[model samples]
Target: MNQHILNVKRRTSLVTVFTLILSVQLGFIAYSGELKSRVPPDQLQEAQSLKNPYSVTKEFVDKGRILYEGRAFCSVCHGRDGQGLPVGPDYDSSSQPLPTNFTDGAWQTARSDGEIFWILKNGSHGTDMAAFMPQYVSEKEAWQLVTYLRSFQGA
Candidate 1:
């Protein structure tokens, strides 16, 4: 009787662990499926029209890297590789969106440079993403950050 109860307990524990993992994965999938523009409707046109004034040079990328990894602390949430770090179990998808996986080719293609700059300048509302320009970084540095972000594409 003792052996049978132990086996049953083990099976139940395994099932519970598996179910938790499945739920987390399903949440990620559901969020990915519903990916939408973070820009406000009123500023979408202007944000899309904005362009990067700086060139995509190594020096600029290096500057952007410094800001992203240092002052801006983008890597704290976005990950050093720009794939985004894991969210806590308390993450609420309805209000707080996940950090963008910059390594995703599809995502890189979908997000325009202007849109990215706009995000940096205005921040994405209802999310953890905060505006960094003018406070953490200048407009030029933001453009450089965009260039560095592009390097993460297909990575």
Candidate 2:
């Protein structure tokens, strides 16, 4: 009887620990506002493998800033601070998610450079993000924009 009681207590303790760990994980996920990748699974492997050809430098970041603020007009939705701006009232919230906050360090760390590049080239699926590559910007410019986006981390 004592051994049986001890076993039950041990199981209860284990269950409590598991519940606590699960609760903490869920809370972190909620607090982090962790975003999932926009890239489709079929292309995810290739997309993630892509590396930036251009070196990260002030010049490249500046060029990207120009494109982002000017022709790309990214600042219109993403905000000049990269914290994301609210969409217009006409935006259909049911269909599209909000613009991403680049200043979110967790989000920045979660996404890959290739994923960003892919979004520029292919646009985010199910969102208002449209393809900028081959239309408003070139491949090189897109890579530069990715570099510039990194500057938003922790900002």
Which 10-residue span in candidate 1 carries the lowest summed lDDT?
29-38
Q: Clashing pairs in model 1?
A: none
State the C-alpha lDDT per candidate.
0.87, 0.90
Question: What digit string (tens of lDDT, one per residue) describes model 2 on residues 1-155?
Answer: 99999999999999999999999998987665447678888999999999998888889899999988898999999999999997779988656678889998888998999999999999986678999998989999999899999999978
Q: Which number leads on TM-score?
A: 2
- Report per-prediction Cα RMSD to one decimal: 10.1, 4.9
Q: What is the TM-score of each candidate against the true structure?
A: 0.74, 0.75
Candidate 1 lDDT for residue 6: 100
Query: Native-vs-model 1 lDDT?
Result: 0.87
Model 2 RMSD, rounded to 1 decimal: 4.9
Name every residue pair that clashes in candidate 2: none
